[model samples]
Target chain A: MEAYEIVKLARDKKRPTAKAYTKELLTNIVELHGDRAFGDDKAVVGGIGELNGMPVTFIAVEKGGDLKERVYRSFGSPKPEGYRKALRLMKQAEKFKRPILCIVDTAGAYCGEDAEERGQGQAIAQNLYEMMDLKVPSISIIIGEGGSGGALGLSVSSKVYVLENAVYSVISPEACAGILWRDAKKADEAAESLCMTSEYMMKFHVADGVFKEDFSDFKGMCAEIKETLYNDFVQMKKEAPEEIIERRYEKFRNIGVFAEKKASSEKGDID
Target chain B: MLSLTELLKKSKNTIENGGRQFARDEKVKCPACGKEEYRNTIKENNMVCPFCEHHYKISARTRIRQVFDKDSFHELFDNIESADPLEFKGYKRRIEKARISSGEKEGVVCGTASLNKVKCAVFVMEPGFMMGSMGSALGEKVCRLFEYACENHLPVIGFTASGGARMQEGILSLMQMAKVSGAVKKHSNAGGLYICVLTNPTTGGVTASFAMLGDIIIAEPNAVVGFAGRRVIESTMKKSLPDDFQKSEFVLEHGFIDKIVDRRELSMTLGRILNLHREVI
Candidate 1:
């Protein structure tokens, strides 16, 4: 499929939002709220739940299932409070040794004045810094649009997976097109040029795996995701906390692509 | 938000027009106040408008020369250059043009330098280079700097001025946030100090990463520093923003920045800070 096709599919309202995934995948959910420092954000729903009998902390950027709810949730565009709330929940989960499961679906972080006033960049920065060494194993699944640093706030995980139709990019294609071609109408070309589709994401090593969507069998699709998370956690649970953080750090550390001499690699020689 | 093309055009104009306003022989009008001053006079005043105290953007090289001890800076990671990992349209050309215009290999210049006679690792972003966007090379250089600081037991000081992650590199540029943050986390774990001086127009992915991770975060006076751009916020909020919205003073009032220092006093402020954090014998 063309990257733009995948981008459209990723944004399709018919596709399941994080609400459905959380409800279907996890059991006995006790929804958490608030960043402790600020009011809770409706866009980001986080809580403790059971993933197939195993306790887990699940956080999802929910775009809402209806127009009213979407308006309330800012159409899944998280604010600084939203990311802070997610970080607060993740820290709580770490305290309880519960594995983290983040269901990412957002156009991007909200760009409103209030979001900036509350330090959106700082909130996301804290998450990226802390999540790198979070003691417990964590996994992030991009069920829809995994947009920029907002998506990445909860996505500095032990492993990241994206649904087949999900698209992730540094900037949305529309914005990229506007910046690159001086026209938002050129989004299709920008989308193609961005290499944002899940397939390209995997090839770029940004995504570890792709989960083919089975929306017709939503329960079955969730079951597969749950199983994958459970199995991965069970294996990850065996590793030491230090090892978990080291692996997480290394996963992101090796993400960039650059040209350098073999001997130059050891320039730091920290060890 | 200004488009990349506009930024590129502005950069080209700056280069063709003899680079920085202070680099020219003609008088330049201060953006904040209409007072005009000769380039040499403004340069002598550390690029701050003598009348309104308006801070003009300084080049990365000039920033280093102004803040660090004379002849103490030794540039590192100059060998690393940006590459088109995703083969995005016009990425290579943009980089090439940025290289020629900015005279820098990447968006940031990293190295070891002495501040107030105290050794520290430093990085200053080149605003002339794609608006100091973070791509793979920039990220790698920052990560390596933090690592070097940790190993050498030196503090790391960074002057941040970026639009955000470079879209040309796609997810690779976005990943730099996590990558650099990881390195910062490691340095923090080792109890190494990190100080960030936020400059004009620091926003987006860079602000969302190591820029805000600094142990002591300072902003230059009147610098436009925020997560989202003014236009983005204005459109999203559907309201006109206050003139001071996202400026350093506003950010300080909002409790994000520790202090706002004038450019003329920045070197002395940094010197005092370094002295305070200097390791005990």
Candidate 2:
């Protein structure tokens, strides 16, 4: 499949949004709202529920599937409020020792003047530190374009998975094209080069796994993901909290390092 | 290089600062005030325009020299070269040029140094080197520095001036955000201090991670500290931003930064903070 086509699929309105996925994946959904610091953000929909009869705290940055919904959710580009709400819910999960599931789908964080005024960088940074230290097991699924820090704020997880159709990039390809080529028209080329496809993410160890989807059978896909997550959770439950945090840190620390095996250079190995 | 006499002759009133787009010149016309000052005078003034207080970008070496005690910074991790991992077009040549132009291995120079006798691990990101973008080389050096600091129970002080992750390195550049942040967390968990000073133009992935995670986030008087560029935001929102948007004053007002320190006073200010915040362990 073309990389640009993947971008389109990730944004397809026909596909189920995070809310729909939540409904399909979890049972007895009890919704939660509001970070103590701010009002609720519709962009980040979070709740506590059961996945395959195991209790879990769930949060997702989702752009609603329809026009009205998408406009209301601001295309899943969260403001500082949304991140604060997500962090609040994650803290609750850690307190209760529940595994946390985060569905990440966003163009990126909101970049409006108001968002900036509300301390967006600090909000995201707080989540990065808190999530890294959270005692509960955490997992994130890149359901769409995991763009920049918006996706990363929710994805400091023990394990991260990306959907086959999802694109995970440091910056949107359009933005990348604009900065590099002085032309946003070259977004397709930028996308091709970002190596943000699920295959590349898994190869680079940025994500733990990729979920191949059968778009027609949404129920089956949810079930498969649930089973996989459940088994992984079962295995992870055996590890201590400190070890889990350390392992997650190490996983991230080792993301992009390699030596080219220089066939014994003239200067020597130490050089 | 133009002499100060010539620069003074073309004073603020005389020079309209019109278009002022000379490609490369030793004389700089202050942005806040149109006073054309010799580059050396501006550098000696800590890169701030003396007439109008407009802060100018300084080289990473100058930044290190100005902020640390005289001859105290023992620069290490200087030889690690960035590989053309993906061999993106002109990337190797660009790295080679950056080496000669910036006089640094990668965008960042990392190692142990002291701030007025308060020892700390220091990493100064050089904007001259491809806008100090983080690639695998920068990331590896930073991660090692944090580990080194943790082992020694020393503090970490970082001065950031970056556009973002190196797009030429692709996913490898993006991973630096995670790698550096992880190393930061390791140090923080060990109860080490990390002071991040956001100088002019700290943005993108660098701002999103370790830069903002500092226990004390100090920014220069007017640093452009933000995630997205002003143009990007303006274009996306179809609106012009406020005059101070993403400037240090704006970021500080929004509680994103703890304080805004003038470049000239950074050394003394940081020394005081380091002494005051030292854990009596």
Candidate 3:
């Protein structure tokens, strides 16, 4: 299928968005959706698939194109169940020793009163904690807007990549500008300053690389992603499982280090 | 072009002649010395008396700098700006005016710094800016800073002083409490350290989340720290307040804060603590 055709199809709510994308990108894709404690969340879409003949786990935020479908998918924002479902899938991937690839595109985690009552915060926190210990190679790609904890719930990885035009940030640029300056008009400035764009993230080491400049060619994009996945998986397989886990753990352990002047009185003494 | 003695005489004459009678009538007596001279100067010096060692109110910035290394401060998420999600009436305009007036991007500055070469991430809330309210941008920046610290295996230091969550953003502002706390937990589970320094006037949602989750919590002497204001609690409960309610010393006595240190000694104490933690790591 052509890229434009896929884009049009993605905008159509008649069929499953994840199923169509998976069929186009990988072979033998399976759908896995639901947290055992509660009902299934349609916002988060996850499953297993074979990419370039290598087994991999895929997770992405699902959005419905139409109003009815959008409401069904919680407007692409996951509730507590959605986060738990992603966590469950991530753990499954770790257990099977399969490489994990996450595609992030959501406004944020669901912020309804119901979501909060069920420990939305706890679920997201658990995902962050569990992802650090996952003993498998992982990569996260921002295909669209990566918003707040909802996007981050499935975004912890050894390498994080973003589409050229993708925006990834802790909060929406509009939300930041509105809250800080009290003017939604300052959103452009907020976006530039927040380093939400892929180019800026790559410069800051937040993102490893940018994918196809224009996601217009689905076949070509899939091929490129396949090659990248294959290379990353091979490199990850070279390191021992324990070493991989340690490296992944350390990757999250060292983010900001500021210089401090050593105390002169304590400088010379071993004490 | 008046001499110091002439200015003093003029000021004295004005006071004696009742030129500033209204100002003289509103004078606050010093509790420790009973002297009406130079009250603000004492508070500016973290409540330490120049003549005697009487501790007062400590600013959030002073507390953070004291605890970190002399030159090891590197602010993280310094460029992340905030927005008004709710677009509440007059909220945007008021924030713009405040931003220009305060000369700060936001109420809090978060970054990576060191205490005695023990690297840690620190956030200092400036009450001068919008009462150091926690909005979406402040929350995101703080959470991201924690993420950075967790990734780097460093400890975190947060100096909190806020009028509570930003009301201008409505529910979005309140959501930051959970967001920041989640980040703090992730950092802690990664074996990172978190030290919360509560300064004057830390209340509301700020206290409910990361501020209360510090592995080692510290506060300046006499700082006001609580979930709600004294008056509100008193009025709601229909009771008179204690002599030292919500004060740092009182909280310390109640075991909420780990210790109450003078502003001048805060840095040295934090340095020692960081050094000890570094040795353990």
Candidate 4:
């Protein structure tokens, strides 16, 4: 399939949002609200819940089900407060030794005057900094659009999974097109150039693996995901806290592609 | 041909206040106040306009010389350069052009330097280099610097001036934000002080990572500092923003930055900060 096709599929309004996954995957969930430092952001919905009878902290960017709900959720675009609220829940999870499960789906963070005033960069920075060393096992599954820093704020996890149809990029194809060629209509070409499809992510090792989508049988697909989550957590739980943190650090530490020039020469090994 | 650093040093030596400095023929007009003066005059004033006090966007080498003690900067990781990972169209040429224009291998230059006789690690991002975008090499150098500081028990001083992640390199550029932040966190956890000087136009992924992760975040006077671009926000809101919006002064008023230090007094301010954090023997 073409890269833009996956982009469109990932952005399909009919696709399940994070709320749907959490609803199907967890039971006995107590929804949490507010960042304690600011107002609660409905775009980011997080809570404590039982994952396969194991206590877990759950966080997800919910796009809402309908037009009214989407408007209320800001179409899954989070402000600085949304990231802060997610971090608060993540901290709570760490304090209580609950493993974390984050569901990511967002066009990107909200870019507005109010968001800038509240330090959007700082909020996302704090998440990346804290999440890297969070002591508890954490996993993020990119269900749809994993757009730029917005997606990365919640994805510095022990393991990251990308749904088959999901698309992740440093910038939206439209934005990239507009910036590169001064034309938003060239998004198809930009998507092809961006290497944003799940296949590229797996090839690049940005994500661990791709989860097959079965929207027609949502319950069955979720059951498989739940099993995978249980097994991964059970294994991750076996390691020491320090070990988990170290592994997570290494996962992101080794991501870039660059050559180190030796002292005497100008170029070293690439890859 | 002299290296850029050596050329700067040569120029600094010739242009002492009373020196003939016959090379002062080149004049530059200030972008802020539109006052034209010899380039040496602005350079002598720490790259701040002597007329309007406008902070000129300076190269990383000039920034290092202005902030660090005379001849104290021992550059590190200068050989590390970028590779076009995605082989995106025109990316190779862009990197080549940036290298030539910026006179640096990457967007940032890192090294060990002394601030008012206080030893510390320093990294200055070059705005001339694609607006100091964070590519793999840039992030690796920063991450390595922090790790080095952690091992040596030294404080880190970083001057950030970036547009954001490099789009040509694709996701690897975005990954650099997390990689550098992880390194920054490790250094912080080791109790190493990291001071960030946010310069003009620090935004996007760089802002959301190590730039904002500094314990003491300072900005130059009137530097445009924020996460999203002003144009992006204005377009989103469909309304014109205030003239001072996203300026360093505005960020200070909003309480995100610690202080807005003038370019002339920045070295002294950093020295004071470093001295206060010094280990009491």
As a whole number from 0 to 100, the lDDT of residue B276 in candidate 4 is: 88
Chain B structural similarity as TM-score, candidate 2: 0.87
Comparison by TM-score, 1 against 2, better one? 1
* Per-residue lDDT of model 2, residues B120-144, tens digit only: 8999998988999988878877888
- What are the runs in model 4 whose C-alpha is more than 4 Å off? A263-271, B1-24
> What's the TM-score of chain A alone for every prediction?
0.96, 0.94, 0.86, 0.96
> What does DockQ come to for candidate 4?
0.80
Any runs in candidate 1 off by more than 4 Å, and if so which?
A261-271, B1-25
What lDDT would candidate 2 get against the real structure?
0.82
Sort the candidates on TM-score, descending order: 4, 1, 2, 3
Candidate 4's displacement at residue B67, Å, is 0.8
Tens-place lDDT per residue, model 1, A160-255, is: 999999999899999899888899999999999988999878887888899989999998888898888889999998999999999999888888
Please write out the lDDT profile of model 4 over residues A1-271, one tens digit for every residue: 9899999999999999999999999999999999999799999999999999999999999999999999999999999999999999999999999999999999999889999899999999999999999999999999999999999999999999999999888999998999989999999989999899998888777899889999999999999999999999999999999999999998888787776776565432333
> What TM-score would candidate 4 get against the native?
0.95
For candidate 3, what is the TM-score? 0.55
Best by lDDT: 4
Error of 4 at B91 (Å): 0.2
Interface DockQ of each model = 0.74, 0.40, 0.03, 0.80
Candidates in order, TM-scores: namely 0.94, 0.91, 0.55, 0.95
